[model samples]
Target: MSTRAPDRFHVSSAVVLCTPGAADRLVETLAEMPNVEVHAAEQGKIIIVIEGKSSGEMGATLAAISSLPDVMAANMVFEHAENLEEGLINGHRTDAA
Candidate 1:
């Protein structure tokens, strides 16, 4: 049997820094973006998760977040990608094929 590579999956965790007294506004703005989830907010910093089918999409979203008003910076803490087809053992797919 022949197998094909799986679709791309990208996940990124980032910390967005807000200007003084700007955390609330930043959180609201982030909430409006697609595939962006605000996990926590405190002391001018917001923890967020970005997910997309491709890394390029995630990067664009991150850049957009950084450009929002009162956003001081958006720094990626971690990033990961997985190919579903690669999760195989003994030439058998670990996940549903």
Candidate 2:
């Protein structure tokens, strides 16, 4: 039996670049995953969020989606709390008058 519990899933964000005319197909494929969610899209880019039990599982899912012929790249934009907190804290400073 495994003694370690799976890593808890939370909010994750990534930017995916799709091949020409492949956004629809890419979104469709991503939609198939149980916890994967496509939040936004533009010209040839897609913004997605995923909830998984572990980093490995999330990576596997992202890899699967990115490996699709229509996908050009799937770069993670945000995936952890520390990243967000730092950005948030920096954004709101006492100088913002």
Candidate 3:
């Protein structure tokens, strides 16, 4: 029997660069997104983390951020995920051992 679950937990980070004087506005816009968290913003660069249930959702979120006004560019810096069920199975085994 298979123990692995099909669902995935996805997390990715991206750096969004805004126009010279648009950093504050871009930060405010990014903060309104439910799945995106702005970690830092300085000058014209903002660091953000995006989380979603699947990779497709993450990609879509990134694309949306890139399209937001005042955003000059958005580039992904990191991506990682794991199957929740699989992680639980392995965790239980370790605990029992």
What's model 2's TM-score? 0.70
> For model 3, what is the alpha-carbon lDDT of residue 84?
56
TM-score of each: 0.82, 0.70, 0.83
* CA deviation > 4 Å runs, candidate 1: 1-4, 85-97
Top-down lDDT ranking? 1, 3, 2
- Model 1 has a clash total of 0
In lDDT terms, which candidate is top? 1
The lDDT, on a scale of 0 to 1, for candidate 1 is 0.87
Candidate 3: tens digits of C-alpha lDDT, residues 50-76: 999988899899899989888889999
Which of 2 and 3 is the better model by lDDT? 3
> Of 1 and 2, which scores higher on lDDT?
1
Task: Tell me the alpha-carbon RMSD of every candidate.
Answer: 3.1, 8.8, 2.9
Runs off by more than 4 Å, candidate 2: 1-7, 81-97
lDDT of 1 by residue, 2-76 (tens): 465567789999999989998987788888889999999999999999999888999999999888899889998
**lDDT of candidate 2 over 1-97, digit per residue (tens):** 3344333445578899988888887788888878889998889999999776666777887888778787889887777533223323434423422
Task: Give the range where candidate 3 is weakest over 10 consecutive residues by summed lDDT.
Answer: 88-97
